[model samples]
Target: MRLTGLLGIEHPIIQGPFGGGLSSVALASAVSNAGGLGSFGAHVLHPTAITGLVRDLRAATTRPFAVNLWVPHAGEGDPIDPTPHIARLAPLYRRLGVEPPALPVAPDFTEQVDALLAAAPPVISFVMGVPPRWVLDSAHDKGITVIGTATTVDEAIALERAGVDAVVASGSDAGGHRGAFLRPVEQSLVGTFSLVPQVVDAVGSPVVAAGGIADRRGVRAALALGADGVQIGTGFLATRESNAGDVHKAMLHSDAAKVTVLTRLFSGRTARGIHNGLVRELAAHEDEVPPYPVQSGLMQPLRRAAAERGLADYVSLWAGQAAPLTASRSAKDYFKELVGT
Candidate 1:
């Protein structure tokens, strides 16, 4: 059976989970009501808040929705030391006339995961890396479907070995952070078209092709390449119901999306987003930016300030190559377009 048959959805479309306040209950429900799976990134929220959000999402619609989490590799070093990275970007903050915030205490991942699994959303998707064996088992025990993302075939194979129900072939062109599990972000760049087929063949499970896909053409292409479904992010960012700021939406209308590059300067892990001043400057001279959540911690102050000031250049305005094809409409409209295909 096709993967969508297992999902029990009318269409093979999924609104990929968005971090940084992009996903909303209204948007997720809208898509689910429209016959596609809608998803949200739950890792960014506090455990209590995420539980409430999941409750709210369930309230919005009985249709299926997905909650995403980032399961990090517990590295040897502590995730502190924002001082050195902060000093590097201090000048950028000075130019913007705002003070960079001192780092907060590191987040409690174990507590968050415990809450997430306890909430038991219908689907639990993971990015950056695969979950530990116990994490996957716990989700399965609750009858929650599991999805894993990878930038290369090896990672996809590993995820399949870990027993994910589905795999997302996250190509380099997909916006947000590169889902590199086996290699450094810089070394793991692979496009969606090439990566999807490889992963499909590498594993017995179905694949959901993500990255750079925006419109019907992308949908047709992914299906043609053996992907059972496609997960789209950047295309929805310009939608009216999206949580992105007005100024950020305007940036998407311009040529900014076409010039995007994968840069780790923003949050350490490489993400493809609208290329602007900070990206251009930081890409030149900088250390590897620590690791996933650590890099995200160091840049939080500047990103917050930039978002507040409506300064596009200083923020990591996450976008994908399909960004150029994004339409400024409600997500419902975009959902209609995808289903009509």
Candidate 2:
């Protein structure tokens, strides 16, 4: 089925889910109410929090909306020493007037899945990797649409085999974490323009083009490439209703938005954002950073402090290459502009 028909939305536009507290109920419900799928990235929330989040979205919009999760990769639970990683970031911690926090524990993915299933939202989306067969079957049993993200053609094929209702062809130009699971992220960095048509041809499931897409022009381009829909992040993120920090939003509307570089400094996973001092200084030592959740936890205190002080340097200013095309507006207005409603 086409994305719109399958998802029960009027337009084939999905508001890309934003993890790390960037997603907001206001932003999501606004887009959903405007005839598009709105998504909330719940990877960081506890299981109970996930339930509450769904309830909040439900209270706000009668339309369909999606709750997104990051499928845990292998070895994600393994213990690793954070000493070296902490030492490397000590300077930044001091500069931010904060101390390195204790090793943080990531929310259990299994528990999160259980909570989501119980909540039974209209749609569920996964990134990083595919969910187990039982989970997919259960979601379908409950009449929920399931979407999986892919950065490569092989991954798209994998998602189709996994029986996902749709696949988001997330290219390297996407902001936030790369969802490359079949191979290393470096090997999966295909551009959106190159990826969408290939994925559309590779999978029988509907294809949603993501990455570097912020306006109707990009939406037309994606459809031209045979995509069934478009998933937009940076564009919706710049809207006033989004939960992004003021400094981060300012950068999206500035000249700096024109240049984004992928780095693992913030979360120990490759994510694209406006090139800033923190990214530049740590460019050489990216390999030394600890794996995700740990690196992400380690940086949280500093990132929080930086945001409080309005310091964009230390905050994770995640944005895509199309960020320069973003404008400060309400998400509802932006949705209208996107589909010409």
lDDT of 2 by residue, 119-215 (tens): 9999999999988999999999999899999999999999999999999999888888899999999999999999998998899989999999999
The superposed Cα distance between candidate 2 and the true structure at residue 288, in angstroms, equals 0.6
True lDDT of residue 210, candidate 2: 99
lDDT score of model 1? Answer: 0.82
Worst 10 residues of 1 by lDDT: 72-81
TM-scores for all candidates: the values are 0.95, 0.99
- Identify the leading candidate in terms of TM-score: 2
lDDT of each: 0.82, 0.93
Candidate 1 stretches with Cα past 4 Å from truth are 76-79
- Clashing residue pairs for model 2: none
How far residue 199's Cα lies from its native spot in candidate 1, in Å, is 1.2
